[model samples]
Target: MTTSAPEPVAHGVGRVRVPMPPGTGLPFSNAYLIDDGDGRVHVVDPGSPTAEARAVLEAAIGDTEVGSIVITHLHADHAGGAAALRARTGAPVLLHERERDALGRIAIGVVPPDLEAWGVPEDRRPELLAAAVVPTAPAATLADQVVEGALGDAQLLDIPGRRVRVIGTPGHTDGHLCLHDEEADLLFTGDHILPTVNSGLGLGGPTDTNPIADYLASLDRAAELDTGTLRALPGHEDPFTGVRERCAALAAHHLRRTEEVAASSGATVWEVASTLTWTGGWDALAGFTLLSALRQTAQHRELVSRRRGL
Candidate 1:
């Protein structure tokens, strides 16, 4: 991975790509340091739970104080380092209020899906269940990570000089958010949108609303931004512009997948997922990959069924 020095995006906004732990299947996740127009800096998505990751973020913060820690979502690769940083700086941790509530209800670990219900073959069930050993929260998540505080939609952060407003975009997770800085024309999108990868949906655990539906609406909210000039600093990958076109492309991709799900109306999620496209082909999916594929297919299937009133 190319080591990046803290690169300035705007006058006080800088992007640091924190390397993810090996085996995460990705290169790195980004952590942004936004000068609150005061002496302190506000950190966004501090990245992996690894000490090396925290060190990278700490180096970016240097001697400057950390005013607040804002997480885009609770995913480890995104918010994992929050606890350590918060402890070090005594800075309050901020996330969507819904995510704060989720922390209270956070399960001890991820519960394995019902293999029979998803129609996984009996032989495949054991391997999939084994992968369920993963935790629902970051391994380093601490009790202090609890309160500290939270974020709200349309709320402007207490950055004295910058006009950073929170835009609630709840698709990737129930409380996923993107920060829009009208003053800087920059969007700190936390997995809400990416330049290349199609981020998986419904990762934030069970919710009453359809994650697919929530995601589409969330995309619409982001599309309303001044995309012509707004540069998006995504949770992963390099920073990029063309927010509007990228939004449309992401929407179209999901819509196409939805259409594919609709066409195979009567199929089980496992069957439907097999017919639809996957990065490595259906036959190659196993364990957690297979589980994720089926769950996503189920979400699309549910969306289609809901629309049909079936």
Candidate 2:
């Protein structure tokens, strides 16, 4: 497989577009390689764990030492290759503790009753139930991967000449993190805030808190980045400027969903979701995709109800 070469983003930042598995909606996931100018590089979000992608990454680094592997979250598309990369590079792996917890839950798999709660029809239930049992065993899951260090919010990384701050933006996943290069005024936004597409909340795993609420708060947290000269290097799209505007747009997108959910007339989650508009049309969605839509619809309805005391 011929892999694409890394594109230079800035003085030391490089973007590697990792190809996703076939049929996945997106074209590719972006993995950023940060060279600290010390003959060592840090790999951020080593996209999918495919031999081609790994080869491309290995070739890009050449003889440079990979000192650290930082995961923005535990989602397979983003953190899937961390373990493989760590094994090859011997680099210390770091991620938010909460991301580890979510991975743990994924290992356990979703239960049938939990699927039942989504109000899916009996005929459609089996597909979702089957999805709970991840085809590959638990050991292959991202959460089960080794972690050399745990990150905390506002903690400064000791990367040479780089003042990288770990911003805990937990809405896309319970432990999603964004790396802020304070010196360069760059924000490495994993799945938390993408350049396009309203990233789904609670997709990481089941959470104790309302994901919609967490997602909104996370958006506000992302908005704190001073926009004077900030550029966003997102996980899935091209590098973009105007971080503040993008964050606000994400927030407004969710607000519209909340209003739609609140106004929808439905006795069940499925009914409410069917009434609302989906990108591919509600009826066109089926299987796990439909399940995700219903799940998100229910969550937004819950949030709106809580806010209005309805």
Candidate 3:
């Protein structure tokens, strides 16, 4: 369900909640519109591809020149509308270099083959395979198009009123980025640190590093940014303070699971996952949900193994 229209967060910042299609997991994802003091705008994480969402974003943009479409990551709920928005506004879309390549591969039907290796039983394999189907751009012409430019770590964007620096935080996805508004003491954490959800790790494109390890290191990086009182404007939840506490909590949450998976060594990913705790219990998860559980469990096990020299 979409919430109210875009509301101001700061002098030049506003947040809009774009409703996802029913049963998409989240109630609504957020997109941010930033004014450059001039008439130009920089849109962040234009969520979803629905007409309704487009309408909401359009209303928020009003008559401003769209300077750039900046994507925090390439997840469907975050970057699904990039191509469409770019087409309409003629604004260049910017993404992390790794995510650009990952999205391109996804558009061409190159997906991960880790499912079979997870040792899921044959009876449940179909559901997992179905879950792995990622939606690409609406048109074949836009399918291979991800972004027009790349945002590197620590690079400052040329937005109007804000000195926004891109911070590379890989874990949720390799090349995941968070934008820091130093002037405002605000950090735009894109699914890297949420208020409520312990968002699944390694859920993005394939990565060469261990996702759990990367996630922990990313948390540390986030902690260092907490000027003791920095506020965080996350992708899914409302704006929050205590950035250090939130970052520590997210890290501890995963490390606890790492301990659980560590104890279940020598078991297959599916078997180990079946023994761990889930939101609705292990047996209740199926299809993509179950596959996600298994994959994260596998990632945790690998992280533990690497640490212990197993």
The lDDT of each candidate is: 0.82, 0.78, 0.79
Checking candidate 1 for backbone clashes, the offending pairs are: none
Using TM-score as the yardstick, the better of models 1 and 3 is 1
TM-score against truth, every candidate = 0.93, 0.92, 0.92
| Candidate 3, residue 108: how far the Cα is off, in Å | 5.2
lDDT of 2 by residue, 104-193 (tens): 676676444365566678898887666533322222455545556588899987688788999999887788899999889999999887
Count of clashing residue pairs in every prediction: 0, 0, 0
Sorted by lDDT, highest first, which candidate order results?
A: 1, 3, 2
Q: Encode model 1's per-residue lDDT on 264-283: one tens digit a residue.
A: 84456677788998878999
Worst 10 residues of 3 by lDDT: 135-144
Q: Residues 23-73, candidate 3, lDDT per residue (tens digit)?
A: 877888889988887778899999888897788878777767889988888
Greater-lDDT candidate between 1 and 2: 1
True-structure lDDT of candidate 2: 0.78
